[model samples]
Target: MTAGGDVGGHPVGPDVAEAAVPRPGPVRRFLLRRPGLVDAAVVTVFTGWALLLGLGADSMYWLHEVLGGPRVLLMQVTSAVLTLAGAVALVWRRRRPVLVAAVMTVLGVLSLALTGATNGFELGVALALYVVATTAPPRTLLAAAGASVLALLVGARVLPLARTVGAKSLGVDPDDADAFAAVTGSGPFGFATSPAWFAMAAPVVVLALLAVGLGTLVHARRQRVAALAEAARARAEEHAQRTRLAQASERAQIAREMHDVVAHSISVMVALGGGASAAFDWAPDRARAALDELVDTGRAALGDMRRILGVLHDDDGDGPAGDAPLEPQPGSLDLPRLVGRARTAGLAVRTSGLAVTGLDALDPALQLAVYRIVQESLTNTLRHAPVATDVEVDVRRRADAVEVVVTDRGGTAPATAGPGSRRGLVGMTERAAAFGGTVEAGPYGQGWRVRALLPWNEGDA
Candidate 1:
């Protein structure tokens, strides 16, 4: 299976756990990638050693003397066959560990029965048990162990050497059944002929079962912990992604507000310049003054736009910066220039309750917001109420609040549609709300009217 696929169905069993195993360094990693080659090399060396031992003087003598006269050949042949089968089975051990373990266990029993001897076959049985305990599923390994223990018990009963050893050690009179009872307790313990026999064999069997159970539990626990850790890591990554998306949405909203402010201011300059250019021949002096005011208004708008853009361009633009100082932004202090520009554009603009002192008392952001609101209001009047001969502007500062109102005299001219109509009004309302303020703009007596109320402490500018 591919590495990214579900680990459960991986060709290697779950007990071949990635967590229990340490990551191999360069040389060891290279060797592990081709396990077949490594197995082939190991098997070749083991086969050579087994062959050499089978042909050796001491080994041949022991086998011939221990086994019967004519049966010696059969015993040697049986041992050789079991050895060859086990070596071949190791090649596919990981793919079918349970089946290979069962096969090896049966071969062990067969070798013992045929030769009545423990040799290379014994080593194969031990290696098979290790593989079963390490790689097979829990149920399969338990079944294999049960089968192996049964085989071992039966083999011990039938083998002459096993009987002789058991009888001598247990002190049981072979002819007397009552003596067997005296030595071995009844029930499960009765599997052995006597207590002495149980004492010799039970310890080894118990130790093997304990090792297998402990290893399986350890492997399972580690796997569960690793899975939980992976899940937590995925959750953390998802949260970070959501936070970034929220931040991006807030920035887009700010950009739209700035665009509305700049667009409205630029539209006024364009309209005034167009009107002055068209009347230059009929009213040269008045038109020239209007043209000059248009230049100043255009420059002021550009400077305000650049300042707003600078904030938009900054990395920490969304939050306050306490350590770094900020320059003053345009507000009511620039209202006289705004009024003069509108008057030059052929509207009679009158000012009352105007106070330019203490302008620096307000926050820079609030100041800028106030300037944009007033500028947009005057621009709207010049473009939409051109025939209105007189306009009134009022600014009053109370102990707790500041109020502003702009109105134009009744006229017959229809209101003109411009780029900043609906969008500019929406922007002004949003800006006023930002500093706990409110604005009202619509037709009120004869011409359009605009009014804003800002709190002194809360909406200072």
Candidate 2:
């Protein structure tokens, strides 16, 4: 909303936000650049010729006398004035094209009837019809053009021939009998060899059709331009929508990483800290060892936390990751360290078949799923199974799957951190599910059990 051109909370560039209007095509740009000047120029073209032709028409005295009216300038001057007035309507042709065209047609008919001659207002009518054609729909354009042609033909051909015959029957003076003939002889409008109805009708129809044809062609080009503009806008909006979805998915991934790193590390440190404090009174040596273990646990947690956070600082891929320490993806190689951490936190863990062959042939994504499942299961045992003395971690590789099972003997333990949020379990299940795997977790006798199956193709394995 600022003068600097901001739209919908985004700072649009100066080149883009010029007036916040839709971009203009060639025809529209011309009219929009100087609308008043364009209107004035159109009015001048029509009005200038109309006024000139009005001045050259038969004298008012001759026209009224020959048409069997009074020998005054009443009808002649009136027709001239009406024709000039219709010419002024050309200025507004673009804004009210059909209305202006209808008005001009009516004025043309009146002028022909009053003096039995055109005052060059047909040119103005033709221009108005062109405007109407450019703006009106196909059906409307057809109707308006048809009506205009019929009215002009009646005014120029049928009405004049009838008026002349009436004037002759009324015994008009012989000297003024050729009024209609003289009017159509030659003037600003092209000359007609004969004043007969058919002679006049042909020109009237041709002019009207020509105007409509030009208008229709312009409208077709304008429509094509408008359609292309609409398509471009749709593509831009789609791309923006895709970018929003990508950002949302990335944020969710960051939340999962933070939870996994913080929960496991913090749980083990708290248990070590508690044990050290409890033994300081009676067993000084034991307390010292516990404190030392607590320190070591804190350092390891800090290192893991740093590794997890290093991903947030974008590296730009030039070389170093902003000088932040790099870390490898956790996998089967880290299983021994993981188990050691749980043992340090006072959990007795037993492993079987930890060195499964062909484990290295697994895809990184599948390996990641396996590692997170085991880590989350061990963290759950440490937090919820304090009374559990034996924790078993079993790894087995079959022809088409890698299976992991973690179980504790005594699942019942006094709660140290109230209730669980259950996000850990959800994260584990989600990771396994990403690679078409499944996890089943529930109670097994007095202890809890978590079993995971990550399927793999033989070619991939």
User: Residue-wise lDDT of candidate 2 within 307-367, one digit each (tens)?
Assistant: 6666666666543445546666777877888888888778899997668877866787777
The pairs that clash in candidate 1 are none
Which TM-score value belongs to model 1?
A: 0.57
Backbone clash tally (model 1): 0
Task: Output the TM-score of candidate 2.
Answer: 0.78
Cα RMSD for candidates in order = 9.9, 7.3
| Candidate 2 minimal-lDDT segment of 10 residues | 165-174
lDDT of 1 at 459: 48
Clashing pairs in 2: none
Candidates' C-alpha lDDT = 0.62, 0.72
Report the error of model 2 at residue 218, Å: 3.3
